[model samples]
Target: MQNSIFKTAEVTDYIVQWLKDYALTSGVKGYVIGISGGIDSAVTSVLCAQTGLPVLCVEMPIHQAPSHVSRAKEHIAFLQNKFSNVQAVEADLTPAFETFKNAVPPSDNENLLNLTLANTRARLRMTALYYFAGLHQSLVAGTGNKIEDFGVGFFTKYGDGGVDVSPIADLMKSEVKAIGKYLQIPTSIIQAKPTDGLFGDDRSDEDQLGANYDELEEAMLAFENGIQATNLTGRKREVFDIFCRLNRINQHKINPIPVCKIPKELK
Candidate 1:
């Protein structure tokens, strides 16, 4: 069964009020978010708009698929019609990304080069969001979910993860979708397959992550609760193994960087 803890109206109200309180107390004139035409961004943008603060939804398409861009615009239109404080803007970073890619010498290692380029795109989008946020005296609200940000480190450091505030960072992917439906987010966006929109090859998030969000979230919960992998068998054991391996490999993203402390004598 899908996680149902966050499906309540109270959770929705709590998040909306939380965004309102944070923006008001911080004295930010508004909030800015990168609208990726996915459920996560859709839910996040709606929450920010519900705060009645000026919400800037930026469509930063850097070599993005045409359908994704269309859906983003559609969502933006929906928000504009629903909330007076909501505004949409487009910051196409294609040329900028091209310049950055061209600056780097061609590599024989295609996978490494592609990975580096994908991360560059994410960072570029982050920069664009901040640029608008600065102009409006707003905060950059992130669209990350718990499983992606904390569970598997699916986000790039200082890329999509670079934000002034994260309103839904604790919710899982399923929870985000549930909230999306509650928020009356456009059906197209709510049902669209999740993607980072980073890879030029059009690889879906599932293709890159190996396992889907449901399996990942289950593994994350089990791991957090001290569930032993040895206790599982058959398909359960296989999924657990994948989660453990990914968690071990991606711990650096979730953990703080190591600092070598010098002893008093050395100092």
Candidate 2:
């Protein structure tokens, strides 16, 4: 049974402990987060800052991103003021994205453009992030929440998921909202409409998944709870199928690769 009342401090403690555990496991010295002005990233920024490691917040906005680029920077500024170890850096990916678009003209392989273009943008941002991470000698932190991670294999493989540590990948969207409030994150961030801002004109993640966060979260939780009765309708079911497929296909994303090698003696 799921807990009815989500405890704030309990969630915050989990996040803090996640940061500590990552430090111990990776033997890394510090942390880095990409602040897209979204709630999950905002919340993760605060948690990583509180972990007492040097937290480098990178703002990588492309041409299509709305004015939230500045809004994101403002939030980072606030975090910087509050957290002594926080440092703000900017890496504009607009030029890089455009270069990629031009350099890799449309191919006969349509999926390449649809899939690869998206991956290109993601890799560009992380490309800039890797430079900063190397300079800061910090681990790249991921902000994907459980709901998004479950839907449509929603992220580009080896792109956005590329990171040294992910603190909230286990928390659902609803749980993340609760965690944000507990951490005293700005209500503006908490209430903002959901979007990936990958393309302009209010294009959002839900538009991509054909599933909303509420249903996605519920279905994902239901799947985890071992209940097979839960299901979606029409296009929504299609989205759930994507979620299920990704979960089954990408189990390796969350674990180390398995290798079965023969010892010379056995051979």
Candidate 3:
């Protein structure tokens, strides 16, 4: 399945309008976004700013790498300079993370402990975003794209996934880049490798997923179109398997929360 072509200008306009409509209907003043110095967050913040409403760009760094921190600051500065309604704040989460680390019991499984800590960072950021949202009467706008949110479920549940509105959830990573370029997002950010910044390392999303966004996108599209993997071979087959495995394992994140239904007779 081929990726859909979209005009950046038209799509941008549509998203900005949709944001405005949602905010107006929900009675919120604006949006609060946690900028991660990645392409998705930068694009989402810009889209939110384009709505001509108050946009709070929060930088929540939990022992974040220098490069990620710099890129996030650069994006926030760019947004503030370009959009009058854009505001910026930094919630240094390193200390909070350390405190939480001391509180949790030690685990013999280092890998599990590291993964759990990484997810805890994301959830901490989510908490910070909501704090600002509640203080400012704004909605927490999500930065997830199509591949991450639906294809592979590559987000922390109740963390980055816990958002009031998703402005770019439907757009693919490539599509988000196109929109980012159209919006003239900082060149440094536009070219930077995608990373979740949860592990406080230079490792990228590709490093974690074992497949790049483009590869993942292709596999996702193919799977959605019911393309049989039996005919695939080599790298394509590997990527398809990775996508399938992630999609299967992360269904709990992608789908609505399960609710046990009571039988009518029980009432």
Candidate 4:
């Protein structure tokens, strides 16, 4: 689907230029990105490479699926061949993740434990990204897109969401795919099911959300335009409810962190 507001080529160029400007102004050597072998990361990494600055693409996998690992390696190789400044590293974090799991106290609820561990994977990856960023004087460039970052808040707070800069957070998922195609991101990545890869399984993001990106995007646009839920029916209504429910419950992830303030006199 074509975005009515911006052409793909133009948007791609704009983002690349924006990244260059942000990195130069911040005096950072480049960007450190965690490559998940998904469209978002592939596109974001490509854009970062276009900046002509050192771009470290780190694949920090913790019990990752083989397909995700292969795709990630393929993307890194593609980037290295195309951009001289792009570098790749693999930090197998399975041992670290196992150690963390052992250190943490067990919970009775298996479901909650699974979910918490998934988020833990993301946090571990985030820590790895920052470690490389600090060591190389680079900023952590986030790969979140519009639908995940804002619409449904699908990203892990302070995990995948922790970053010095968000290069593609404003673009919708469809737009990101378009940009990815324009950048010639490996077809394997562009066509692969979008997965967080936190669960070490084959489940796609749609499987977890109970709705696909297209459906969620439609609901998001409708909600933004003040379309009432009552007007929607059938699957539309169901998807809208899913969008709203997730949007509402995940506000803590979407909004700025709350800060407690004391009165001036008390201070």
What lDDT score belongs to each candidate, Candidate 1 first? 0.86, 0.76, 0.93, 0.93
Candidate 2 structure quality by residue, lDDT tens digits, 163-223: 7777888777887888887777777778877777665446667776666777677667657
| TM-scores for every predicted model | 0.94, 0.84, 0.98, 0.98
Residue-level lDDT tens digits of model 4 in 1-267: 446776888888898899999999998899999999999999999999998999999999898899999999999999999999998888999999999999989999999999999999999989999999999999999999999999999999989999988988998899999899899999999999999999999999999999999899999999999999999999999999999999999999999999998899997
Better of 1 and 3 by TM-score: 3
Instruction: Give the CA lDDT, 0 to 100, for residue 164 in model 1.
Output: 85
- In candidate 4 the C-alpha lDDT for residue 231 amounts to 98
Compose the digit string of candidate 3's lDDT tens values, residues 1-267.
224567889999999999999999999999999999999999999999999999999999888899999999999889988889999998998999999999979899999999999999999999999999999999999999999999999999999999998889998898999999999999999999999989989999999999999999899988999998897999999999999999999999999999999999998
What's the CA error at residue 175 for candidate 4, in Å? Answer: 0.2
In model 4, the Cα lDDT at residue 250 comes to 97
- For model 4 the TM-score comes to 0.98
- For candidate 1, the C-alpha RMSD (Å) to the true structure equals 1.6
